[model samples]
Target: MLPLLLLLPLLWGGSLQEYPGYKLQIPELVTVQEGLCVIVFCEFFYPWHVSFTTDQLCIYWYWTGDNTYSNRLVATNCQNLVVKTETQGRFHLLGDPKTNNCSLSIRDARKSDTGIYEFRVWGQYVQYSYRTQLNLQVTDLTEKADIHILEPLQSGSPTNLTCSLPGSCDGGRPLTFSWMGDALNMLDPSTLQSSVLTLTPRPQDHGTYLTCQVKRRWPQVTTERTIRLNVSYPPQMLGSSCSWEAEGVHCSCFAQAWPAPFLHWWIGDRLVEGNSSDASFSVTSSSIGPWTKSSLSLSMELTSVLRLCCEAWNDHGNQSVTVLLLPGKSASRAEVALGALGGAGTMALLSLCLCLTFFFIVKARRKQAAERPGGMDDEDPVMGTVTWSCRQKPWPESTPAQQSHSGDTPPSREEQDVHYASLSFHGMKPQKSKDEEATSTTEYTEIKTSK
Candidate 1:
């Protein structure tokens, strides 16, 4: 029972002892931008009976190991440290001892104000003490903000953007900058004095804007400069040599210009429209210069003959050139040459066909005549032999009446009857006897004598 009594007293004594002294809490480091405000807070604890009195409270603020009066009197209860004559208008000491709240405020800060601050507090009786370390980081708001270029104004040209902010600030303060567009951040902190952004100009970059934001130890402040990029190039002239030979209805017009330009074609008094044909254009840039030259070609087919006009225009400006084309003279020459060639070729073909036809017709007629029967006489003996026989009737033996009347005297009826009988026998059949042969010879001889 005695031991229990002793233990209870010991426990009561432990509980009755004063809690630990109030301790000021200070962050290892604090960052603030110029022309801004920051708060440094201090915390502590005290017994309930010890009421906070101005006489009992003595608080002092100073730099580390500061011996000069100028460094020692940042704040003191003996002399009221009013807002006037303070480094910053917002600087002040605020606390509620009942709640153990102690804090400091700084306003309109500057880069030179960056330093470590020490707070010392003393209380009556126990004479409690607390110390806190403060690191003030001073940065420039202007330094924390930046500028960036979004795009370039020329197509196919190299362009650069810049993100720039004021760089004159406390060296200990760090800054970060970035871009807010299609371009990736490629700036190296070591090489960059402040911040910058860049990109190459392209056709896709037109009508786009770029922005820049900067971040530092303080709350981020942004300043943006927008750039509207318009990628433009020279107009392209398309077509072949400007000459009169290329005159006709709906002549082909073409121009190959990038960043497409307005195109038009004209012939004589007519404004030829919708007669443009596909044209090829090319642009080449000098590697060392800012200018690029472009060539364009277009073909226009038209019916009229006059000066051919080609005009190309863009946002930059307009360019046009005219070529005189005498359709009558040029067309006539071309037509004559073509017609002569065609007629010559046709006539040569016709002559050749006619000659061939004539030769074939003559050959065919001769072949048909040769093949016809009874068309040619068979007279030449060298080719084949042919025998022919002729039959003759012997003259009738001289009438016997006539022979008897050879001397001019008249023969009687008996002579006439003998002549008739001989004539009748000859008509029937003549005998091939020696008397007949001799009588035939006598008749032949008498006829020769009569002749």
Candidate 2:
């Protein structure tokens, strides 16, 4: 009866003190990704006892359903106790129970480690367990590594890039880091396995993928981050070529740069804009990726001299090149030598036709004047003139005295009035015209008339 009375008070006081000051301050749930880490902050309180000392406090974290001594323990501050083989180094008791701190730190968490956990405190003449439990949920690792660039990537300049995984701590399974990308192909092979990379960017590296991969050896977990590089660079002229197409010169110029450089066609100091057309020149431009191509087609006269230039520029810098649009006329060239030649030939042919027309007109007028009446003055002269009279008024019978002397009979008065006259005509051949033949003639005539 005496031993029964002594145990009753102890049992009654334990039950009454359980809910008053004994409590655990900790989150009810904790979530962590596999192969990552987490920290569970905790603090505990209990009724003070005269025989208990802070130095003798021992904290135990149990993984099994029951807190019995036979169950496996994940973490404990007592040096003589043993921890589970699976969580030997992974689970840590970071806080000292002497300060009422019962914090737990987990590293390289595994999926099998998900379960309810309880905190127990033991000391001389006192032993207690918090009814509040911590539930851990470890799911698939869906997080990726982070890549940080120190500054904007510029061509020909060295830059640093850092890679790190989120929720990773100093004391955990060592992670292996590696870099993968087209831009890293030219670098030393040994440098690709480091967490930090030194990169010298170029114009060709723009828009190329750069990947940072992180791997955990213990759990064989992998995570990666990919980013496209943006490298700023000056414009670089690739090449320029020209060909005669139909009636104009088709010229193409190529340039490459970051930020898609603006292309322009220059004739001396004039700026040729997009799809511009005039009497002598036309231009068109387009871009794809980092390359820009500009085309110029122009028809100019043969006598004209033109100098064609292709210029490209961006925020970084500028580039330019002079293009030859013709073969032999490279000294002072036009867009199309063939077009210019064709134009010159047409003008020459028209001039020739006009000259022939004028020549024929002069010859026709001279021929018509020669056929008219007074056009012969330079080729023919006038001949002698002859005069003749048909009427004879009594030649006076050869003068009446002459008739008497010649023993001519002078008839009566009427016969003497009717005198006879003789006239003679001599014809000389006149100058023949172009189409006629010359002739000669002579004739004599006798007439008698009464006055």
- The model with the greatest TM-score is 2
RMSD of 2: 38.4
lDDT string for model 2 (279-342, tens) is: 8888888999888999888676423224466777788766665532221222223544454565
- Clash count for candidate 1 is 26
Q: Where does the lowest 10-residue lDDT sum fall in candidate 2?
A: 435-444
Lowest lDDT sum, 10 consecutive residues, model 1, at: 442-451
Compute the lDDT for candidate 1.
0.44
lDDT of each: 0.44, 0.69
TM-score of each: 0.28, 0.54
What ranges in model 1 sit over 4 Å off? 1-23, 29-90, 93-103, 107-116, 120-128, 135-295, 299-301, 304-451
The lDDT leader among the candidates is 2
